[model samples]
Target: MISSTLIFQSEMFSDWIIYNDETHGEYLVTVDHSEDTCYCTCPDFQYRKQTEKFGGAKLDDNEHHCKHIRKVIQDGCS
Candidate 1:
């Protein structure tokens, strides 16, 4: 879960930003602006979201965004 008080700092890259979350022992969150994607190297991201087997069906929009991604957007992204 994303905390209302958690703050993140990001290191800018050419196409993505590396978000550093201090609340979780400086965990890194990757935010890809070009692809409008976000990923975290956390257990939650791996177990919950990434484990989904889409099979032959199209993925739902709600399935893509995680708490890390939401934090990045909440920090300041239009």
Candidate 2:
């Protein structure tokens, strides 16, 4: 199960504190609906957030795609 807590919310912005079950690591997630982007205080997210594709057509949804971001979006940003 995913463990997360919504720390802040507003019309266009929100913040979430989520834990990685595997490592039990905590990360701060920020979602901005106005920009249609999400950010996470995690190395994986930081490294891959700007990557469009990894191995010539492997593909990604967008520039701001990651597990933490997905978790936030899954929780419903709108």
Q: Estimate each model's TM-score.
A: 0.47, 0.71
Residue range 39-70, candidate 2, lDDT tens digits: 67787776656442321111134445666667
- Whole-structure CA lDDT of model 1: 0.45
Error of 2 at 13 (Å): 0.9
Winning model by TM-score:
2
Top candidate by lDDT: 2
| lDDT score for residue 41 of model 1 | 60
Which regions of candidate 1 deviate over 4 angstroms?
A: 1-24, 51-63
Clash-forming residue pairs, model 2: none
Model 2 stretches astray by more than 4 angstroms: 51-64
Cα lDDT of model 1 by residue, 1-78, tens digit = 343333343443111233444554334455444444455565666566653352111122336555655565566542
Model 1: ten consecutive residues of lowest lDDT: 51-60
